[model samples]
Target chain A: MTLKRLLSERRAAILEKWRDRVFACYPPETASFLKREADRFSNPVAHRLTEGLKGIYATLLGEAPAAEVTAQLDEVLRIWAVQDFTPSQALAFVFFLKPIIREELAGELKADAGLTAELLDLESRLDGVALLGFDVYMRRREKLSDLKVSEMKARISGLLRRVGVDPSTL
Target chain B: MSLPKPEELARVNYQPPARGWMEVKPDFRPGTYCNAASPKWLEWIDYPYPRQWSVAEEDWQLPENWKEIVLEGMEDRLARFRSLKLFFDICVRCGACADKCHFFLGTGDPKNMPVLRAELLRSVYKRYFTRIGKALGELVGARDLDEKVIKEWFFYLYQCTICRRCSLFCPYGIDMAEMTLLGREMLASIGINIDWAMASVAQCYDKGSHIGATPQAFKDMIDFLAEENERITGIKTPVSYNRKGAEILFVTPSGDYFADPGTFTLMGYLLLFTYLDLDWTFSTYAAEGGNFGWFVSHEMGKRLNAKIYHEAERLKVKWILGGECGHMWRVCNQYMPTWFGQVPSFLEVPVSPVTGTVFENARVHKMVHISEFTADLLRHNKLKLDPQRNAHIKLTFHDSCNTSRGMGIFEEPRYIIQHVLPEGHFFEMPPNTIREKTFCCGSSSGINANENMELRMQGGFPRANAVRYVHERYGVNHLGCICALDRATLPTLLQYWVPEVEVTGITELVGNALVFEGEIERTTDLRDRDLVGVGEQEGGEEEE
Candidate 1:
């Protein structure tokens, strides 16, 4: 079978492993709560992570366009960007899928050269996703910086106008 | 392969440290804390022990007598405020309030728990003041005050928005916000203050508003808003500032003068005041209704709040009409008369000039909430309203925490909303998340700084989660709130979590629904967004 077909066949197992690795980045107490809570409104972080991961895995298996995958990454990484995570740590979850995919399809890849080439291609796609996650993360960080400047400008616009300086120019 | 395994690329530590919470020092992470008070503002306000300090540094550069000052401050507060001493003395630790905090729910940090957050100060109270705590020490859940403890207090206390959701769940009725207020006051005594609050305090002290709008700037902003109102509704609303003979002096948070969303609410006020032809004036002095002093100390609160009554006497207004604000109402409703000994004799109890309704609820403070005033107008049919004007929006109300819990003025805004919107257009968020159990905007009480966006995001998650629910389930695109700070912060909070949802002040909706006699047919709401169903033709370019 092709690598994409194999990943599709073992989608549940791979998504489960990926979810654990991503959830493990939080504290133990928080990690377990995120795992146990199923209500979306009650535990939004976990809900967002779950829905985003499912969308990402489905899109990665060629069910949707590549832009759909970036949209999924944006939803997940937006949470991590503002969270207590460094840049590397924030995007690390995308890479975690690589190890899970390798382990889940280890036997098929070793038996066939075509499957091994396809696995390399898939790993490269995963690397692209990680790079896309970096873009998503930076967008959020830039938005945060813009928000800071906007908040300051909004706070002081009246003062700026009084002193003969246009706040909009700032 | 020459490289290490892909699984080992990241080191994930899910386990917390083995040490108990008391032993753990606060992690001074960037983006999670606000900066220290500036010496310039400290000097402006004459805060004691004014000096430079940063929470990120190892040494905080506290005063040499910080511990003594804190202890003395505690002792003095305990003697003065009976509520503080009672809250410290009576706590069964039932954990009812442990999960009630939005910060705790959002961050999952044990210290964010209200019981533990209060215990941060209560533990010091135990060791320094109580015999059992001194004799039993850690066994009694008490620890001696130290530099690290002070630092931890700064981190955790500021994390709380002082929303008072926890006090609702407490069996003992412990006002945990009072503890946070007193803890923050003690910290302020030792020259530890955040710049977000101090800057406003300094500005309000000198320039008459939190954003420091001068008398001219305030008028210019009103003129600008009035021009916008004329463009939308074809009415040129007359506005006055510091006018002596005006029957009513309207005081609102200065945020309405400059900021988005809040400025829309200001436009709403101008439209309503013009529609009513009621005599009203905005005060340049006492321009800000939000008391940043309440976030600092009782004395500071009284000092900043004194301007309102002083302006009323000078302007010779009959009574004050407060605009949509959270903590401002808390100060005016609960503490204003007490702080000033009584409402000034120059002002009479507020009787709404249009409806001729005596606001007996505001008898003691002699100030009426705008929502209360508007709801009364709706009840009396004093103004023309067209609910179809708000037909384009799906609405949900976020009860500002202080308005719900502190003042219990819940139904007034809802009553006005009921008259201003169609039946199916407005929906409630969850029953538990509304009214008394409301969550904070997570950036109020002067903690809405840009540097602390992460903390604000996390703390705001619970409230945003509810908004997201209505967004997905009911297609709610608009969130209505009464507080000025909520108007400023909830937009950012909603944009981050639920990007499709937007925030508006309740007055904005009312302004849209309000009909002026012989006025031009409107095509836009207060924010200049196109109104629904007003001019759209079927099968035309306007078809979505």
Candidate 2:
């Protein structure tokens, strides 16, 4: 069977492994809360991670455009951006899929060179997802810096306007 | 140079830490904490132990007897404040408040949980003050007050916005915000402080405002606002500064003096006062309604708050008319009178001059929220309002945490909104997310500093999540609130999370909808954006 078919069959297990691994990045108490709380609004960090991962996995397997993967990762990565993660750790979840898929499809990979080549191609797509995650993460960081500047400037914008120094021009 | 293999990295242990929570030291990550207090402000204010320090450094350069100071401070507070002592003794630890905090819900940091955040202090209170804790150390869930404990206290207490959402859930009514204030007080006693709060305290002390706006600067902004109001409404709004013998002394947060959206609300106040021809004056000395000192220590908060009553007495106003703010009003409603040693003898109860309705609710406090004042006007049919002017925007109200819980002001803003906006234009966020159970903007109680945007975002997740719901479901374009901090912080929050929705002060909407007599046809809202169809309806059917 082709690698795509194998991945399709093992999608559930792979996703579960991926979910736990991503959650494990948080402190254990927080990880458990994120894993167990099912309400979308009550547990948004978990909700976004679970939902964003599913979207990413589906798009990765399908012939969807590259933008779709980035879109899927945006929400999850946004949470991590504001979290206590370094850039490497923030984008680490994307690379995490590689080993889980490899371990899940270990038997099929060893048996056929064709399947191994297909795995390599698929792994490159995962790399693409990781790069897209970097873009999303960096974009969030930039947004944060911009937010800080604007909030600070906006605080005094009224006074600035009265002083005849247009804040927007600055 | 090589990183760990993917499989190796994936092998994360999901086990709880063997060492209990007390043993886990806080990681002073860059974005996690606010900048340390500047020694310049400390020395200017003559705060004790003025020295340069950095939170990022391994050594905080704390005073040598920091532990004794913290313990003694805690003991003094416990003995002096009955409420603090009662809260410490009363927590059943039922964890009812565990999931309630927006910070906890957003960050999923277990320490952000209200029970645990308070326990950070309670554990020390146990080890140092209680017999059971001393006899059975870790067994009784107590630990010694070490340097790690101090760091943890600083980290978690600042994380709390003191919204009191947790207290609503506790059966014993355990107020975590009060405990946090106590925690922050102890921290300050040891020469520890957050810059965002302390800097503002010093500025407010020196320059009579939080942003250090001089008396002229404050008047300049108001003059500009009046000019803008005239350009929009064709009626020049009259304003006064430091004018004595006015019937009311209007005090608002300094943010409203210089922040967007807040400035619009200030315009709304100016227009309403002009329309009423109310005898009121703005005291530049008492310019700031927000008490950042409230977030620091009680003594400091009292020192900062004393300006309002003093200004009132000097100006000889009948009463104080406060603008839309969360913590300021919380301070006014709960602590101001007690802190001021009783209502000023010169100030009469706030009787609305336009409506002649005695504000019996504020009889003792002798101060009135603007919403209450406006709602009273609306109830008496005192203002000419065109609800259709707000037709272009779909709106929702976010109850400011301080007003919702501290004062129980659930209806006044809503009453004003109903009178000024189209009947169906308003929508509530959700039953659980508003009113007394309202979520914080996650940046209240002096956490709205720029350096700690990550904490603000993470802590604001629950609030933003609810806004996203209304934005998607009902197409809410405007989020109206009555808090200065909300106006300052919620805009950044919505821009990041739900870009479609915008934040506005409730009074801004009122300013947009108020119809001036003999005015030219309205064209634009206070922000100068074109109002839909208002300018076009020159000679058409009346908007009665």
Candidate 3:
């Protein structure tokens, strides 16, 4: 079978496992809220997570272009980056897919020797996506720092400006 | 845009650390917190903390006996209130409330937890008051009440909005709000309170209102509203001030007298009273229902809260009808009678004469939430409404933290809105984020100061996040809440997070829907903007 056909056939089972592992990163209460509520508006935390994973899933299936995959990585990492995760822990979910993918496609690899070569390439591709996630995480941190500086100056800036003491000058 | 979008990352990541929370010192970064309290109000309130300290400065100037003052303040309060003493002992730190605080949830700072916000003070309470804490010291989670501890208290305590949502879930039923109130009281004892909170308390104490709007200023405001009402309804709404014979004394948050959207809410009160031909008078002496005193200290809260009862007695009004306000109702419903009770017998149970609905829940307090009163009138079909007037606006109700959690006023405001807005216009934010479980406006409790915009946005994230969801789904153009501060600050909060969504008070919707008899065609809404092609007419955009 073709690589796309293999990923497509087992898509539901693999995605479910990947989603559970990602949702498990959140506390039980938060995870339950995200899991129980499916509406995009009410359950935005879940929607962001799922949409982010969908981009990754589509990329793995060769359905999404590289740019689309990067945008999805940006969207997904934005939420995870700002959360209570360290640099390593934040993007660990991306790398987590390697083991899950290897396990889910184990039968395919054993059945066809050619599939083993495709799995090797797919593993490296996952690592590259992990690198992309790291870039997004660092960029998010810089944005936060810039926001903090701008916010600090702007806090007393209104009063300072009103009183003829230009905060910018200070 | 504004409320923490997971976009404003904190420079100091408390996600993984080697040290315990108490061991970590709080550094006041420029963007994360508000500037220190202004010296002028601190001096006027006779607060004992340093007069000219700055948060950005390296050293916070402290008095020689600041520790003694704080210790004495805590000792005095512990003796004065049983709840304070009980709270100091009751906490086992099981961490039930660890994730409950919005600040902690948004910022990932453990100290912002209700468990730890109280623990910051409780750790000291143990060192000084408890036997094991003094004996065991840091091993027992007890730390000396040092300058670093004081700075940490200033940082984390300000992050708490005292919304009491955490209190609802605590297994011990320990009120973190009560603990923080005492913590802030002790802080204020040393003049360590934020200037934004003290500013309103000083104004409310010296002037009749928290905003310092004098009687003449209030009259001028009422005159403008009356003229605006005349333009809309072609009937002049009579606003009586300090009228001795008036049967009802209507006092609202001073925000209503001065601020936008809140002013529209104030207009709703006036238009409804005029429509019913109700006899009510506004008292400049008790013009402010907002008790900033509640935010800082309990005694100061009483001094400010006493005005409603004192004015009701002096004016000989049968009862008082409070306007839509947030912490105001928390104090009125839960704290008023306890603070200034055995309220004079002259005040009767507030029964709406038009609807004949006796507001039993508010009987002893002798004050009714304006939404309760309006909803009662609306339910009984007493007021003539043209909800179609507001048909152009699509909105959602954001249950204010206090009223939903503190008072269970969930259905009243929603019932009123359902009647006032065009059908299907109102949408509920996620169940976890609304009614009793509502997220705060992020700017409540004195944290509303301009300096703490970063923290405020983070704190407001859950609310704004939920709002962004609804804004995406329902194309919700307005967020209607009952609290007046929600009116004043949410516009800024929404502007930052969901710029398309605007904030409005429940009564503002009521005012727009009010079809006054003998009224001229209103070409514009209360905002004085052209309304001909706006709102329910086509699907609504921003009202302006």
**Model 1 error, position B280 (Å):** 2.3
- Once fitted onto the true fold, the runs of candidate 3 whose alpha carbons sit more than 4 angstroms away are A1-170, B1-15, B528-544
Cα distance off (Å), candidate 1, residue B340 = 1.4
Flag the better candidate by lDDT, 1 or 3.
1
List TM-score per model, in order: 0.90, 0.94, 0.80
Q: Predictions ranked by TM-score, top down?
A: 2, 1, 3
Return the TM-scores of chain A for each candidate in numbered order: 0.88, 0.89, 0.87
Top of the candidates by DockQ: 2
Q: Which stretches of candidate 2 lie over 4 Å from their true place?
A: A1-14, A63-65, A102-119, B1-18, B533-544
- For model 3, the docking class works out as incorrect
lDDT of 1 by residue, A76-117 (tens): 887778777788788778777877887888888788778887
- With candidate 3 superimposed using the best TM-score fit, by how many Å does residue B138's alpha carbon deviate from the native? 2.2
Off by over 4 Å in 1: A1-21, A36-38, A61-65, A95-125, A156-170, B1-5, B10-15, B343-346, B533-544
Candidate 3 chain B: minimum summed lDDT over ten consecutive residues — where? B5-14
Tell me the tens digit of each residue's lDDT in model 1 across B1-544. Answer: 5564434554344345545778867788888899998899989989887888788889989889889999999999999999999999898888888767888777767788798898899999999899999999999988999999999999998998889999999988999888888999999998999998999999989888877778777788878878878888899988888999899999999888788778889889999999989899988887889999899888899999999999999999999999999999999989999999966788898998888899998888889999999999989988788988888889999999999988888899989889899889888998778899888899998999889988898889889988988988999999999999998899888878887988889998889999988789777777656777545653365576
User: Model 1, B443: alpha-carbon shift in Å?
Assistant: 1.0
- Best-to-worst order by lDDT is 2, 1, 3
- Give the Å shift of residue B107 in candidate 1: 2.7
